[model samples]
Target: MATNVKVIAGDPSQGRTKSSPFEHPYALIPTPSLPTDGSKPHGALLNAVEMFLVHNILIRAINSILYHAPLVKLHDDIKDFLHFCEVFVDFTNLHHDSEEEHIFPEWARACGQPDIMNENVAEHTTFHAGLQELRNYAKQTRDDTTRHSSEEVIRIIDSFAPALTTHLRNEIPTVLQMQQYPNGDEQRKIFAKGVEKGAAQADNTTQIPFALGCHDAGFEGGKHRFPSLPWFVIMGVVWWYGGTHKATWRFCLAICIVGQRRRSFEIVVSEHTRR
Candidate 1:
């Protein structure tokens, strides 16, 4: 749960490296560290910021897939790619739903600021339509491979990427600002409960594996510890559950069960190709 991690920008121009594929083709949002000193909001609010940062990593991974994956040459790989896109849409929607349903209301009540999170809510709306369109496109393509259009998928992402990324990045500071209130302990409990409720509703089989696949355990010299599942869950449950969509998980930057770093999936048609 180390929170002092800095943002890492994985430039595709650097070519394939020994790093985890999750870290490539985009800039990751950095998680702000909790102050060791007796800071006002040193507890749950900071932890929420950390979790948001983790989600941002996955967000960037989906963007990487859109830009870096060799969709045209993929052929059979397109099936898994479409499935991956579906998983991305599912995870993002669930995260936002959980925030709106469980986290935001509670925070507003506790801080006596009902409209505090309205901006974030509005931001979600800005990207909702485009995200749904991408979801529909991915599902349609999955059902009928002939419908697969990499260009269309990229266009949909382009339409929403600005608003989506803005919301993702802006929410961190808003969470941090909650420290101005003297209810760190209470805010901590609210956030923890929201996370628990969200986790309880997630699809362990697909969403869990998809998240682990995008996470890099060795990030920032292995300082960050995210998705803090036990070894048993990682080795046993994820290993078996991910079997349902093994092909889709293969496109993941890290092994779905274990966060081992590997090269991201990409196709190099010519020596001068850069994506």
Candidate 2:
């Protein structure tokens, strides 16, 4: 896949610049992006914050199929379930690789606490092997063209779910707390750099749309967290390159958030609170 970079605007509102004397060493950095009026959960953690929620939604999708697909007696349902697994695995690898290689380092640098994210990085090792095995299984299921054991696949996925979910849940607060970095503009710059790096590594056909599909832009009474390009441009890219490869996205909660409304390829969110 050829590399492409997408530019998105940062939140216009500025946050508090002062550091309190009583504040902890890693005080949360004030940001205009984080909700102040308490209208919604702020998305200003985990480097690419929105991606954090999107990751949870993906894990939920994978877990749902693992638990429920076994009860499905029909062969077609089993097939569809396996297909969803493939999408989940691919999307996860793409996301994780980006985090490990690009995003985490930025957060660590901004925090001046390189060791702060060490545990999160270590947690990735625990599930790395399981993720690889699951991906291999997904591929084998696709290529074998035979009736595969849904029970076995579910067990494989279930084995990894606990660890994966732990990392996902634990990360929310870890990242939310990173707001103590004391420089919102610098933090925003780091975020943009990470997004650009991830975009360059992405496959426009599969990964781009898959990432878009994972985003729940409707969070907090229908608002997005990033800037957007023209609707036609985004739609054009997805339609032209994404092709007929997005079967599993419909099952994602992010897409369901908008109900029957047309999906946006552009990523957008408001950093302001709903006062």
For residues 86-192, write the lDDT of model 1, one tens digit per residue.
88888889888999999999999999999999988888999889889888887888777866777888888888877887788877777878878888888888888
lDDT of 2 by residue, 32-51 (tens): 25556866442354354565
Worst 10 residues of 2 by lDDT: 14-23
Please, what is the whole-model Cα lDDT of each candidate in the order they appear?
0.68, 0.55
Name the best candidate (by TM-score). Answer: 1
How many collisions between residues are there in candidate 2?
Answer: 11
Q: Report clash pairs, candidate 1.
A: none
What is candidate 1's local distance difference test score?
Answer: 0.68
